[model samples]
Structure formats: C-alpha cells, structure tokens
Target: MPNQSTNGPSGRPKPECDPIKDEKMGLMREVGGQAVWSLSSCKPGFGVDQLRDNCLETYWQSDGPQPHLVNIQFRRKTTIQDVCIYADYKLDESYTPNRISVRAGNHFHDLQEVELMDLSEPNGWVVIPLKDSNDSPIRAFLIQIAVLSNHQNGRDTHIRQIKVHSPVQNSIVSVLDFPINFTTVQMAQHSTIR
Candidate 1:
C-alpha cells in the first residue's frame, strides 16, 4: 500500500509541464528516439516512463538512499539549453531534493560537472538552464540529487515529471489512408478508439 500525500479537500498543485507552452521544445511531441533514458533506482510502477507523460498524476519515485540519479544518452549530439523538473506538486514534501548536481559530456566516464542548483525551499517545478562552456550540444546529460528534504516520517523521493529541452529534430506527419470511395464527410462521420 502507498501513503496518500493528500486527502479530503486538499488543493491540487500547479501544473508546470506545459508541453505546448515553450515554443522551442514545447511544440514538439515526445517520440521514440535513439536517446537512452534511465534512472539509478525507482520503486516498482514508478520509472522513467512516467516522466514523459506530461501529467503530474504519474511520477518517478526513487528508492534506496539519497543521490538518486537520472541519466540520458543521445543517439547523436543534441543541443539542450534547459531542463524542467516537477516535484512535490501534491505536497509530498518527503524526498524532495534540496541540491542537484549536473554532469555531462560526450563520453560516460568522462562526464564533467556543469552546474548545480540549490533550493532552500523545494516545493514546485523548476526550469533549470544548463550551461555549456562551448555553448554546443553534448551526447549525454546526468542529474544527481545531493540532498533530500525532510518528510517528518515518510520514505522515498518523488518526482512528478521531467522534461529535457532541445531543438525539434524529426517531424512526423500521420497520413490517413481510408477507403478510396470514402468521402470527407463519411470519414469524419464517426470516430473509433482503435
């Protein structure tokens, strides 16, 4: 069983993930790509997949101790300027990160520290701008949680969502191939879930 963060008439937290709000990475939809995304550790049913849903209801909850990590690898070099993280939206104060360390590079072992963010009060979603010395793209990026907020009596760190910002690569256009005799009015007559 899981402990409910809120009950009764608690208010819903602000939604920070507006996929269509930011024009840069906003207009682009999440698609299957060569980039590899992984988490160092997560509780069952809460994994990296939840981070892409754009909804706060689903999230990635970290297991074990502090310093949980989120790692990403690109198929080719990609330029990313900022990263957004939504946490504690439902008021699950426990496990919110106080400080975060960013590491990135072309190679895994060769990754270097790029930036660090210190949140005195870790409460809502944050947009962190990544700094690249050369101002160029990299092949990999990593985020490590250095400190966790006190929960009073709770376990596990919770992250409601995460988004990586980068230039839109490929645009997919779905073509509808209906019956040759089918007219526009007929095609639009009814809709099917399939």
Candidate 2:
C-alpha cells in the first residue's frame, strides 16, 4: 500500500514512465541467499534465550578455560537500539556475573560493553542498548560470552532473536513501490479473481 517513487531529472513523471510499473518489474527479479544466518533455534551458548524469557542465570568469562562466541552479521548498515543475550543457569548455581565482549568492523579492537540490564519478567528478555559513545556503525558484529570457572558446565546459554530498526539507508534492491488508483481500478475490474 506504500507509494515509493524515485526522483527523475524533471519533477514530473517522464514520458512513457510509470514509477509503480518499474518497481513491480524490478521486484520480479530474484535476489537469493543474501542472509548469512537465520536465527532459528536457541543453541547452548549464543546468549539469546535469557532475554527472550527474562532470566539472567547465564554469564560470560574471558580468563576461563573455555570461551563461547556468537557470530552475527547484518547485510547492511542498521540502527540497532536493543540486543538480547540468553543463557540458562541450569548447569551452575553460582551468582557470579559473566563478562560480555562485543566487536565491530574488525578484530583490531573491541567495543566495551556499554549497558547491561536484567530482564524484568521471570522469563523475559535481557535488553542491551547500543548507546556507547565509542559505538561505531556496524554491519557485522560478534559477541563473546564466557562463563567463569565457578559457572562453567553449569549454565547453558542460548541466543534466540535479535530485533533492530530499519537503517536510514535501507537496501535499494529491496525497496517496493505501489501503483496509483488508475491501475488499481483497472486490475480490480478486469483481472482474474482467484
């Protein structure tokens, strides 16, 4: 239902030009396999489930023996407001907090954890905001959640879903445009009713 239009050389529509038609034709083209990973199930160490269910028994460690890492990629620049990391305390009963490491752009230097909040609901979500002064525009990023020795092999962490807002400049190829009333009326009267 949204009307999308591209600016032409002149303000008015050019001869034999229909913005809606062009967009519809473009949509016919197939752009396949663009996403790196689709977040489907909550695995053992992704740190997503904790936030989805509003629990924080999972913790990350850096100096511990084994370190768990979650890798994620955004096809384009995105304005991320909140991030959720999930983990289970089923394995460990300790109350020690885990360290969360974030990396953007490359591995040259990592971004420090800006904010960490416990989910309000019993099994809700852990919301982490991307408001750090040092936070840079990110297309691809990685999170490392390491469990301390005290909590190792005790808690199972799972990353389920990540929600973000549309970037200022969204993917041009994915843009869609709608037809005006003239075409709408014509299709409604003449098109096959299936």
Q: CA shift at 107, candidate 1, in angstroms?
A: 2.6
Off by over 4 Å in 2: 1-35, 38-65, 88-97, 106-122, 134-156, 159-194
- Highest TM-score: give the candidate number: 1
lDDT of each: 0.59, 0.34
State which candidate has the highest lDDT. Answer: 1
